[model samples]
Target: MRNTFLKASFMAAMASIGAGEAGAADYRKNPFTLAYDGAITQNEPGKVNIHPVTYKLNGLDIAANVYIPANYDPKQAYPTVVVAHPNGGVKEQVAGLYAQRLAEQGYITITADAAYQGASAGQPRSTDKPAYRIEDIHGMADFISQYAGVDRKRLGLLGICGGGGYSLAAAQTDKRFKSVATISMFNSGRVRRNGYNDSQLNSVQQRLQQASEARAQEAAGAAVLYSGDANLSDEQIAKLPFELYRQGYEYYWKTHAHPNSTFKYTTSSLLDLMRFDATDQIALIGQPLLMIAGSEADSLYMTEDAFAKASGAHDKELFIIEGATHIETYWVPKYVDAAIGKLSAFYGKTL
Candidate 1:
C-alpha cells in the first residue's frame, strides 16, 4: 500500500512538472519572480501585508520580509515566528512561502535573507560560514521581538533546509525562541565535511587542504575562490547525480530563479562549515521541538540523526511527510500543506 501510494504521488508530481513547463517559460525572463503557489504578488488592502525590512546585524544590514497577519492591529500583541530560508535561497522563495502561510494561520511571521547573501549587505558575498548563519538567526530574534505587534515571550521559530540546521544550532543556546521547528533539515556541516551520505569520506583531507589554501589566498587579499560555482546547461543539469541536486537546480535556476540565489559559496567557508555540527550540542535545546522531513528524501538521514541527538527537548516530535523528497517539500502543495499543518499544530500548542 505504501509503495503504491509513493508511485501515485511520484506520477502526479511528474505530471505537474509537465504542466508547469509553460509557466516556467513565462518566469524565465525574471530572475526574482516568486513562482510558488499562493505567492504574494502584491499586498492587498486589508489582507496580509508584506513589509520589506532591513535591520543591522553584526554591523551589516540584513534584508528581511515581515508578514503582517490579516486585520492586523498594533495595539494587540501577537505571537510571531522567525523563518530561516534554505541555502542558496532568498527571502522571497520557500522561506517566504512558509512565512506567508504562517501569517494566514494568524501568526506574524518574518523571513530573512541570510547576511552576505540574498539582498542582504555584506562584503565578499556568498560567504556561507555556519557561525555567521547562526548569528543571522540570533539577529532575526533580536529584531522581530521588538516589532510593533510582537509579543517577545510568545516567539517561535521555523527553519527550512540549511536554515533548519542553523536554527537547531541557534536554539541550542538562545532560549528567546519559546518553540522550535524545522522542515527538510539539511546538516550543512556533515555534508561539507563528509559529502552527502559520507560518499566522499576518502576526499576529506584533500578538501580540507583546498579550503585552507582558499583561506590563505583571501588573507593575502587575492581574488576570492568559490566552490560549487557552475552555470550548467539544461542537459547538464538534467544529468546531475542526486535528485536533491538535480531538483534543486530546476527549482533555483528554472522554476523559481532568483538573481541572488546561487549555489556557490566562498571556498574558505567550508573551513568553518566542515568543523561545525548542528547536532553537536543538540541536547542543550530545552524548548518544544518539531522536526519535519520527507519520508522518501535522501536527506532524511540528517533529520533523523539530529532528532536522535536532541535529548534535551523532551517534547520533541519527528513528523515525516509520506512519499515526498527533500526538494518536493519546498514547493509541492500536498507535502508543503502537510508540513504547514504539522507546524501550525505544533506552534499552536507550544507557542
Candidate 2:
C-alpha cells in the first residue's frame, strides 16, 4: 500500500509540473541542455567547450564538466570552484549554469551531479540522504585534485539553493575550501525542520508525522512519496504557500521543465534534512564567507540568520540583490552577474 502510494505520488509529482515537450521553454539555454539523452548512467558534457570527466566517488559513477582555465598548466596552479546543486536537482540543472558562467570568468569549475539525483549513482533513486549530500562535496574536492591544472591550495565553493547549505557544511568541516559563497541559498535543514522563519511552527510537527510514516514505508522496501508537487488548477495554484513557490513551478515546470528533470523529493529525506543543520556547524569554519541572496528571495532570511550565527568565520558578509527572487538569482544576468562579480572579488581577496 505504501509502495502504491509512492508510485501514485511520484507520477502525480511528475505530472504536477504539467510536463510535456510542447509545454514551453524550448530555448534550452542552460548548460545541462547539452546533455539530455536521458541516460541515467553517466554521460559526457556537450559544447560549452568543457572537458568532461567521469570518475568514481564512493562507488558512484560521478560525471563532471571540468573546465580548466586557458592559462592552466601542469606545473603552474590555478583556482578551482567546486559547484553543487539545489535539492531534488542534478548537476546538469541550474548548478551547471553557475559552473559554466564561473568557468568563463577564468576559474577552473567542476559541476558534478549529486548522488542518486541525476546521472550520478545511488540505489532507490531520488533519495536525499544528508550524509551523502555532505560527502558529495568532500568527494568533489578529492575528485578534482587529481587534475594537473588545479591549485589544491586555492580551492573554493559555489553552491546554489540547497547546495548553498551543503557548501557551508563542507566548508565548516573541511579547511580545503579557502573561500565559500552561495547564490539563492537555503538553510535546507533548518527550513525543512522548521519552515521559513519558523512561521509554519503551528503545523511543522504534524508534517513531521506525515514524513515519518512515509519513511517507515521506505524502510520496508517500499518506495516513498515525494513532497512539493506543482499540480493544481489556476485557482488552487494561486493558493500556494509562497509567491516564489508558485513561480518555482513556472520556472521548473512551465518555463524550464525538461522531460528529464523532476521536483520529487524523498519522503524520508525530510527527516535527514531536519537534522542536517549546516548553520549549527558554521562556527567551526575559518574561511572567509560570502553569502548572497535575492532581496525578495523568500529564502533570504536564512542567509541573514546564518551570518549572525557563524562565530569563527575569518571574514563574512551577506549581500541581498534588489528586486530579485530566489530563482531569478539562479539564472538572471542582473542577479547572477552581481553574484559572479562579487564572488570573484571575494575569492580574489581571500583565496
Candidate 3:
C-alpha cells in the first residue's frame, strides 16, 4: 500500500501537466481567458478586475494577470500577494483562481507564467529549472510592488503545487516578501531527485547520468529531449493506480486545461532539478509563514516535512482541509473556500 501510494504520487507529479493540443475553442471560455471555474467574465467597476500584463524577466517576456479588489483606488494602499503556479501549470489555471479569489477579498494579487512555460517566452520551451522558478517569484514581487497603491511592507506570497516548493526557496533569501504561504505545497526538487516519497531513491544516480547525457546532446546541436510528456487515452488514464494521477489528468488535460500548459520539461533540466532541494536552507525564511494542505492528499507528506523544517519561521502554522485531496484543493469550491478563508486570516494577521 505504501509503495503504491508513493508510486502514484511520483507518476502524478511527472504527469501533472499532461500534454494536449489547444484549438481556437480552447482559447478559454471567458473574456479574461482564465480556465478556472467562476473566473471573472468581464471586469466591473465595483468588482474584482483582472488586468493582463507583460514584463521582461531575464530578457524574456513574462505573461501575467493582476487582480485588483472591487472599488479599487490607486490612492489607497493595499496588501498584495504573488502566486506561483504548479509544475507544468500556467497562470491561467489554479494560480489565477486563487489570485482572483484573494483579490475579491480586497487584496491585490498577481499570477504569472514561469519563465519558459505557459505564455512566457524562453527557448527550448518547458525548461523547468529551480533557479528560474525561484526568480520568477521574485520578479513578480518586483513588478507587483511597483504597481499603484501597493504596500511594499505588506507584500505576501502564495505558491501552489510545484510553485509552493520554489517559493520556499525564494523566500529563504528574498526578504522582500513580508509574509509567505503555500497551498498543497509540492517539493519539486525532492520529487525529481528522490521521486515522490523517495520511491525512486535507488535510481537517482542513473537518472542524473541520463540528464547529464541529455545536456551533452543538447550542447552538441541535437534536438531537445523532453520528459513526462504523455498523450494518454481515457482507458489508459483510468488504469492509473492512484487518485492523484487519475484526478490530475482530468484536471490538467480535460476540465481545466489551457493551451500554454504542458506536462513536459527539458530532460536536461533534471541536472539542475536533481541538485535542488526546496527545503535546503529553508530556515532562512524568518518571516511569518502559513502552509496549508489537504489531509487526504497523497502529497501531504511534502508539506508536513517542509513545515517541520521551517525553523526560521517563528510564526508558522499548517492548516489542513479535511476530506480534500491534492488536486481537489485546487478547484473544488468548498476546498478552495476553506483554503482562502485560512489564507485570509493568515495574511490578515501577519501582513
Candidate 4:
C-alpha cells in the first residue's frame, strides 16, 4: 500500500515536469526566475550587462558569466567578486542571481559553472571531487583578477551552499581574495562523510567501501556509477523528510530547471569528498570573513561550526536570516535582500 502511494506521488511529480507546470513563469526564456524583485531580463543600455565567458582550466573549458556594473568603464578600476554555485547548480541559477544583484549594487561580479558540470567541459561528468572544486574557485580568481577594469587588490568571494564550503577552503590559502563570505554554507565533507548533522556516523565505513568499489569499477573502464540522481513527483518531493531536500527539489528540478543542472555526482567522487573539511585550515584565512545562514535551516550547524573555528580572521561575523530555511536563502526576496544588504556593507567596508 505504501509503495503504491509513493509510486503515485512520483508519477505526479514527473507529470508536472513534463507538463511544464513547475511554476507559472515560463522557464525556456527565464530560467532565472526566483523571487528577486527587480531582476534584469535583458542587458539594456545603462544597465548591468552580462558577459558570457569561457576560459581553460586544467585543460577543461570552464564557462562563466561576468556581470559588469552599469556605467562600467574598462579604464577605471573596480572591486570584483567571484560567486560560486552550489553542488549541483549551474551558473544561471542562484549564483548568477547574486552576481547580478552585486552588479546592481555597483560592484563587478562573476559566476562560473564548475569545470565538470553545467556548460563546462569534462568527461565521466559530474565528478564532485574536492580538489577539482577548490581548483575551480582558484581558476575563477585567476581569470577575474586579470579582467579589464578589475582591481586585483580588491578581489572578494561570495559562495553559496557547497560552493560556500569550497570558498572557505580556497580563501584559506588564496590570499588574493581580500574578503570572503558564504550563504547557507554546507560543509560538504562533513555531510558526505557522516551524513547531514552526523546522522549517518555508523555508515561512514560502509560508504567508504562503496566509494572504493566505484573507483575500482571506473579503473576497470566500466560504466560510471552515480549517486543522488532521482526523478520524483511533486507529491514525493513534498513528503521528503528534510525541508532542505524538499525545497531543493522544487527549486532545482521545477521552478529553475536548466538542461545542465543536476543533483548527481560520480560515486567515486565521495572518496575525496569524505576526506575534506571546510574548516580544516580555516584559521589560515586572515582576511575578513562573513558567514550567513537561515536561522531555521537544518544546515545552520555547519555554518556555526566553521564560524567558531575561523579564529584567525581578526574580523568575522555570523549573520542569520530570522525566518528562512536553507533553500529560502537562495530565492526568497526578503531573505535575499537581507543577505545582499549585509554583503554590500561588508564588502563596502573591507574592499
lDDT of 3: 0.88
TM-score of each: 0.91, 0.85, 0.92, 0.93
Q: On lDDT, who's better, 2 or 4?
A: 4
lDDT of 1 by residue, 1-351 (tens): 323433553354344445546344223232334556677767777798788888999899888989999999998888999999999888878998899899999999998889888778786778999999999999999999889999898999998999999999999999999999999999999999999987899999999999999999999999999998677787998897788998898887767665567788999999999999999989999999999999889999999999999999999999999999999998899998999999999989998
Question: Global CA lDDT of candidate 4, please?
Answer: 0.87
Candidate 2 has a TM-score of 0.85
lDDT of 3 at 339: 96
Order of models, best lDDT first: 3, 4, 1, 2
**Model 4 poorest 10 in a row by lDDT:** 28-37
How many Å off is the CA of 155 in candidate 4? 0.3
How would you encode candidate 3's per-residue C-alpha lDDT over 159-223 as one tens digit per residue?
A: 99999999999999998888999999999889999987678999999999999999999999999
The local distance difference test score of each candidate is 0.87, 0.73, 0.88, 0.87
Worst 10 residues of 1 by lDDT: 23-32
CA-only RMSD, every prediction: 8.5, 5.0, 7.0, 5.7
lDDT of candidate 2 at residue 24, scale 0 to 100 = 40
Write candidate 2's Cα lDDT for 78-126 as tens digits.
7889998887666655676677676666778888877766566566667
Candidates in descending TM-score order: 4, 3, 1, 2
Best by lDDT: 3
Which residue segments of model 2 deviate by more than 4 Å? 1-48, 71-75, 233-235
For candidate 3, what's the RMSD?
Answer: 7.0
